[model samples]
Target: MKKAALYLLLITLFSKILGFTREIVLSHMYGASNISDAYIVSTTVPTFIFSFLGVAIATSYIPIYSTIENEKGIQSANIFTNTLVHFVILICTLLIIVAFVFTTPIVKLFASGFDKKTLSLAVLFTKISIFSIYFIGLIYVFNSYLQIKGKFVIPACIGFLFNFVIITSIILSDFFNILMLPIGYVLSYILQFLFLLPFLRKHKYKYKYSFIIDKDTSYYMKRIFYLSLPGIFGASVNEINSIVDRTIASRISVGGISALNYAINLNSFIQGLFVLTITTVMYPIISKMVVESDVDGVKKSLNKAINSITLLVIPITIGSMIFSEPLINFLFGRGAFDSKALSMTSEALFFYSIGMIGFSLRELLSRVFYAFQDTKTPMINAAIAIFMNIVLSIILSRYLEIGGLALATSISAIFCTLLLFINLRNKIGSFEIRNIIISFVKVLCASLLMGMISRFFYYALLNNINDNLCLVLSVCIGAITYLVIIYFMRIKEINIIVNVIKKKLFSSFNVL
Candidate 1:
């Protein structure tokens, strides 16, 4: 488990860095203009339409697959898998057809503030990119299957190919026709599906030509379908909020959507690199524990996962708040990313950072509910958050504009995470909430101190040194300072990590 988590972290980190490069390329070529906005909406439309299904499939499939394998055996499970693949492909095809026919209205729903030219481009892009749902659905199923099979490497590496394809396409689009952008976006997913096929076969996963919907398969399909409905709505909370943000942003300014997208990507980087790596590794294990009726084990894993997220996310959040502008400027200040774009993106990043820990916790907690096969709690809680976000966004955007949209997102996440905690205790009894709070307090203190020093260093060196160099050094210094404070504070999670590193070093020395 440790090795799998670490491997995933490394892969995610590397892929995310490449993914950031992809964003940088996009920003350089297009900035936060109508062209970029149109392209972003085109890509976002499919995700907005289908991501709930994707999340629902992944969250619901894991435990269901485990149950079938345990009771009916691997052959039965494989048949169920075949049935699911066929069913998902059929559903995706239908969705694609519908989306294609209503592409303009769908584009309008996501980006209503678009002018005729921008709206037309978005519609065109959506027409081509909508087919990605087919690949996206299959990828989700295969990814869960591989994770269940304990083959994490290939699933983790797909992002590499996906990002590479995207970056290449963006560059080509710049040099040649802009149509290459959406064309490349669709091609990336196709390549990712192809990339996973051989690995699936290697893991003894065969694709049966026959789609069996026998009694057993039918029962499991019904189970997955029921579970997925709530999961879809539960997962859709975030996507729905995103659609709201983009729609509202479109009304705010020309580059509003692009600014939000860039900032959100930066915020997502932290969640993706740490929170996701932890959850992806722990989700399968926790699902098995649930199958074994290991409630205590589930509780223990949830505590550790939450603590890990807090320890990882809090300091980064503080740093992001302090250095939002510098980070955005450092990364995207060049080329077409002008001063106005910089200010909008930085403002968005700062506000988004406020809810970074909340978002991370909500993600982990939601996964726990899903592992226990209780999606309804999260769905209800998400609905509550969605209401809060919408209300706050309307009120705040009136004042804060882009920042208001972002702050509303953070506030909603924090509130939703709090509700999940209360309901989670009611659902599973106390899962060491006291310890989590204690640890969080310590992490927050350490992070605050680190942020102050980092901010000091940043400002002190601003006049004497290059902006990028100063920002990089200040971040490095902040990281070191954070490590020192946590070490002295003897944070339990940090110590565990320290000891693990020590062991690896000692083992390597012995090998030498």
Candidate 2:
């Protein structure tokens, strides 16, 4: 599991870097302006719409496939896959028509702050980008299929192609018409879908073209639909929170939407790099364990995953908070991203960092509940969180502006994560929550100390060396400080990692 996680981590890291570059390119070309804001809202509308169905289906599809494959065999799973593919295409096709017809109103819904000119631009972009959902839906199905087949490489690589295409499209827009932006966005997903086809064949997946919802298909399809309801509600509630944030942001200022988007992309970077890699690797194993009725194994896996998330994400959260400005400035200070944009983005990033651990754990815990095929728990918890977020965002944004919106999200996530942990313990008859809390405290202490030292080091050298160089060195120093502190603290998770590194080093010496 560690080996698989590591492999996917490297691939995910590369892909996330490219994804970040895509954002950087957009910021460089468009910055926190009406153009970037319109493009973001345009792209977000389709993704938000598709996610209501696509995410719920894709997430629910996994354990369902596991169940079928275990009972009926590989061919049965393939049939289900084919049926789902056709179903998604049909649904997404309908969605595209509705969204296209109502593009202006939908864009208006997301960004009520936009004026006539900006609204027109956003509608145009949404019209083009909305079609990408067809490809996006298929990618979700195929990616889930590939992951079930234990082919993580190709799915992980899709980000590479997807982000590369997006980056290219942004650059092309600079030279050509800005309309190339949405056009290229759609093209990326088409290429991603095409890229996944042959690999599906290589994995022995025979794509039979059948849209007939026959008896067996109907039964299982209905089951998927039933199982997906809670998930869809959960996802929809979360999307509502997002729409609320964006809507409020739109009202806040000119580039409020773009600033939130940029900050979110940064937050997503940390989640993708560690939390996602661990969860993606563990989800299948946990699902299989549940299928085999290995309750002990599931408990161990949950404990380990939770511990890993704390050990990794806590320091990142602290470091991000400490150096938010320098980090944002270093990454996005140039091009059209001026001082005001940097200040807005940096403030948002700092506030968002507060909930990093909450966000990471909530995602992992939610998936665990899904493995148990109990999506209702997460759904209820999400409803609570989203309600809190909506209320907090409204009240907080009045004072904190963009920062308040992000802070509200962080607080809500943390609250939701707490609910998940408690309910999971109740359902599973208790894992190692006490131990996890103890370790979390230790990791928090180490990370806090490291942050202080890193902050001091950064300021000490800020006047002596180049600002970016100083920031990079300070991050390196903080990492070293964190490792040293954790090693001395004898944190169990860090010890496991340390032992593995030692053994690898000893093996290399023997090889020499």
Count of steric clashes across candidates, in order? 0, 0
* Candidate 2 off by > 4 Å: 203-214, 236-238
lDDT of 2 at 36: 97
For 1-512, candidate 1 gives per-residue lDDT tens digits of: 77899889999999999999999999999999999999999999887777888899899899998888888888888888888888889989999999999999999999889999999988998899998999999999999999988878789899999999999999999889999999999999999999988777763665443655656688889999899998888988889888889999999999999999999999988899999999999999999999999999999989988888898999999999999998999999999999999999999999999999889999998988998899999999999999999999999999999999999999999999999999999989999999999999999999999999999998999999999999999999999999999899988888888899999999999999
Candidate 1 positional error at 343, Å = 0.6
Clashing residue pairs in candidate 1 (N, C-alpha, C atoms within 3 angstroms): none
Tell me the tens digit of each residue's lDDT in model 2 across 1-512: 99989999999999999999999999989889999999999999988998888878877888888998899998888888888988999999999999999998999999999989999999999999999999989998989988887878789999988999999999999998999999999999999999988887763655555666545767788878987889886656557777889999998888989999999999999999999999998988898899989989999999999999999999999999999999999999889998889988999999999999989999999999889888899999999999999999999999999999999999999999999999999999889889998999999999999999999999999999999999999999999999999999998878888899999999999999
Task: Show where candidate 1 strays beyond 4 Å.
Answer: 203-212
